[model samples]
Target: MALCLLSPGQGSQSPDMLARLAADPATAGTLATLAPLAGDEALRVAADPARCFANRHAQPLLCLYALAVGAALSAEGVEAALVAGYSVGELAAYGLAGALPAAAVLRAAAARAQAMDDCAPADSGMLAVRGVAIGEIEALAAAHGVDVAICNGDEHAVLAGPQCALDALATTLAAQRGAHVVSLPIGVPAHSRWLQPAVAPFAATLAALPWQRGALPVLAGVSAEPVRAPERAVETLSRQLAATIDWARVLDVAVEMGTTVFFEVGPGNALARMARERHPGLPARALADFASVAGAAAWLRRQLA
Candidate 1:
């Protein structure tokens, strides 16, 4: 069976997210390699939601977690022919696909997070809205000075703008029937017009970096198309910072590409849940759901067989 690896973005992090992986001896080397990038007392930082929620800490930590999990699975001979990531997770996807080395991937992730954080105002944040039509959400966003950051599907999306505006939108949506809005812990208005200032610098940084073609195809988060060239990869990644992501389409592209089995190599099961919701028949599981890397690998091997 052809397998697709899914890397998750922000909003799924928790205090004990990486405890199981950290306890595994096989992940020692991978954790060591990522420790410096994750900062002093990395696990301590991860255990604190307030500190880890910052863009500076969250980006690198998420990338490290995904890379470590993927490495452990690979060691067990779980093969994924295709890969995709959501937002910041794309950097980890590049590393998983062999498009960037470990050092380079962490460096890029740090830089990307810093750049986006710089563009984000202290009062700006994101909100996830569901059970409301995209058109209605767009209308609300236009009325509230917020922008649609991501279109998860026809009736679900994430909005980004000033925190006050999001609060106002939430209040308004609360009044409407069948409308739901949840404020995300993140403070940055990522993937929105507010981050437009960060695009040029991030693109320049990617261009200056030494890049190698990846061994596996990575579906672009913005377009869901297979990106084989480093140039295209850089462009898509940079542009996505200020563009709305169509994640539903990305899932469709994965199925169209013959992905029968899926693995989410990250701290949470958000990606896997989304995939299963979109395609109930597809076999999808998250590494975080397993008690050990070996258990996850065995499950994958069973699916392939």
Candidate 2:
């Protein structure tokens, strides 16, 4: 196993989804321990699934979900050499990589969410644009006031800006060329300048909080590389507000490191799907469902056999 990459973060929570893990004593105990910070609402939101789509709720819940699943895998003697996370998932990545405690992760997540919510504007939102060339999207963004917030792949991306700009882009994408556009459930425009207001406060929170050097190599969503310093944590955390997310780079880097298996440790399988999209040759699977975990584990055992 050259690298067993574990991804933790938002947009993966589903209702009744974690019940299987909760039933497993090894997994449930860790989850039970996090109840105070995470709360029963995490399960309720996971059951609904859509609730996890909200940034305010998703941020912290995903942290707990990531910690729980990552903890379970470690309990099973599975070890990952490198770990990376996207957006809010970065905190969970930190915990799984032993850069922070589960409590600290949740606390940071909660504080971050509150800070983001407090600073986020009411009209701003994000949009997912698919099946378009990056150059075309880049050109479009330049033409409009929008920014390329997330580059999931060379062809797939998300543009963020004011509602008017996003709506105009949506029309343009459909009218000029055939492109799929969907409004992301997230309200605040993430990874765009629209979040500039939240950066400082969130950074201050991170700076005040104690963060240790990571035990395992931890890749950052801000630059798609390993973040090595405690101070860099605050900088990266703050950059999330005004930076573009290069998820494609994240996946490519892991593959280059000989990452044969990717475990998306959370309630949803979004990152795993992205892994398959970005690297079809490599095996990428989610640890969302127990059956999925068992299947991936068995496959890995065969590969490592």
Candidate 3:
């Protein structure tokens, strides 16, 4: 059997999310640790996903949710051969793969969030452009003074730019053939050169952090392959801020690495939807929005069985 792949990311969080999580004392306890990172009011704010998108709230919120799902899977004795993360979700993947303790992962997440927010000025923005060819999107970005923050697939690329540039780009995209754009709810532009100022300080913090040796193969978002050493992982994280995410290529490499079945472990069905559309026939499931604990656990167990 091939390994189960967990998709880590930030796009699908909501405030009513915890209401769906129910009263697992363990998960509740795990949720408690997020308070200090987000604030005593974190849980309340999480009831709406939009609130969590605030820079300070987003980092810790994503880390907490990722940890909650991973902890639940671990408690169920579920194991995968390899794991990978998208952007901020990489920290969660590292923790799940035993590359670092959960506490260390949380610290990294917090630091990363802070660094991005600190480095970004007040007027940058991100836009999700749908129905655009990769070539055309790149061309459009260049023509409009914007950067590709993430290449989700051939049709889906995120553009990051200052507000004025974003407005002009959106107008161009709307006028372009086969293009529609949606602005993202992010505090700062991510996965673009806009984050370059944050790279050095974030890297210095990561260098001081400790990482554990992993027992399972954990792949990289930058290289679309497994990382071999702790330092290598650190190096990737350092460059992450100033790099563009090649998600479609990453998915292809993951498929080649025996990820025949992908279970998106974060709060939204975003990755599952992406995989289904991208591959057409791949086996994929999104696990975070089930109606009940039994429903989710049963679904996962059935898949593994």
Report lDDT (Cα) of residue 62, candidate 2.
76
Alpha carbon lDDT of residue 28, candidate 3?
A: 65
Q: Report the candidate with higher lDDT, 1 versus 3.
A: 1
Per-residue lDDT for 1-305 in model 2, tens only?
65455565444556665676787666788877885687557777756655757777778877887888788777666778788888888867878888788888888888878877786677878888888998899899879898998888888988878888888999999788899998877777788887788888888878876577747777777677777687777798688777998888988887777788777787767888888888887777776544645565565566544
Off by over 4 Å in 2: 48-51, 289-295
Superposed by TM-score, candidate 3 places the C-alpha of residue 250 at a distance from the truth, in angstroms, of 1.5
lDDT of predicted model 1: 0.87
Write candidate 3's Cα lDDT for 197-235 as tens digits: 998998888787777774566677766767748888888
Instruction: Compose the digit string of candidate 1's lDDT tens values, residues 169-229.
Output: 9988878645888999888999999899999999998887778874688888889999879
The positional error of residue 143 in candidate 3, measured at the CA in angstroms, is 1.2
Model 1 residue runs over 4 Å out of place are none
Q: Pick the candidate with the highest TM-score.
A: 1
Q: Please identify which of the two predictions, 1 or 2, would achieve the higher lDDT against the true structure.
A: 1
User: lDDT value for candidate 2?
Assistant: 0.77
Q: Quick one: best lDDT, which candidate? A: 1
| Candidate 3 ranges with C-alpha deviation above 4 Å | 22-26, 33-39, 48-50
Ranking by lDDT: 1, 2, 3
Worst 10-residue lDDT window for candidate 3 reads: 17-26
